[model samples]
Target: MKPSIPPPPTQEDEALIKDYLLHRMLQTVLERDIQIFKTLELTMTNLYILNLQHIIKRMSDPYWTVKHQIRQRGIRIESKSWTPEGEIQVLYLCRGYQRSLLCSWPPMKEELKDRIISYLGTDLAAY
Candidate 1:
């Protein structure tokens, strides 16, 4: 009798494992960053927690209401489904004051760019 060998993992299994690892790494990094941000007193940047609706529904918290922020005023949050490449539930730490300033003067492109850079510490094309 010949000995049989186990077949290699399927593509779906590999994809699922990849996603799980990515999410775990993202969570760890986000947690660390949150601690650092808190310790450094980075009040200018605010952490926006997205995907709260799913959590609320799962927990059956009917009283919980999520106040949606206007993305035009700050860095837009990316959807995990669309942004599978290292995308997570936590949004960037945006500067509230900068967002407000930008909203105050939407027509001024240069002013908006400068404000974003000042707050985010980098010039992002997304802004």
Candidate 2:
């Protein structure tokens, strides 16, 4: 006995298949776009929280003031922070610039500390 072949698809069947495939493709694209949008929203939120431009400006004054000291001691900016305690702390490294410095500038007034930390979207503990 010979094997039987299936009947060819009708035009209506072909149209239905095309429609189903197009629908699936559109759904896939929509899902991908939604994920991308979510990621963008998260990144924007973080950026808003950071407010990086203002943070940079806040650090600039102290950096300029200590630049001469830095040159003399070969100390470099290891880490820096405008702490929630209202202190401008910069970990300056010296001795071939590999050691953490224990020095910190005097704390700003308590009110200022509170304001800065609030704007930074974090508390002292978070910092």
Highest lDDT model number: 2
Runs in model 2 lying further than 4 Å from the true structure: 1-6, 42-127
lDDT of 2 by residue, 10-107 (tens): 44333332233233333344345555555675747555434544554554554454454445544445564556765444454353434332223332
The local lDDT score (0 to 100) that residue 45 gets in candidate 1 is 38
Cα-lDDT of candidate 2? 0.44
RMSD of each: 19.0, 30.7
| lDDT string, candidate 1, 1-127, tens digits | 9976434334433333333333333345445555565566444534422222232233232122111222222333223232344332332223222111111123233443453344345557667
**Lowest lDDT 10-residue stretch of candidate 1:** 96-105
Window of ten residues with lowest summed lDDT in model 2: 99-108
What would the TM-scores of all predictions be? 0.32, 0.28
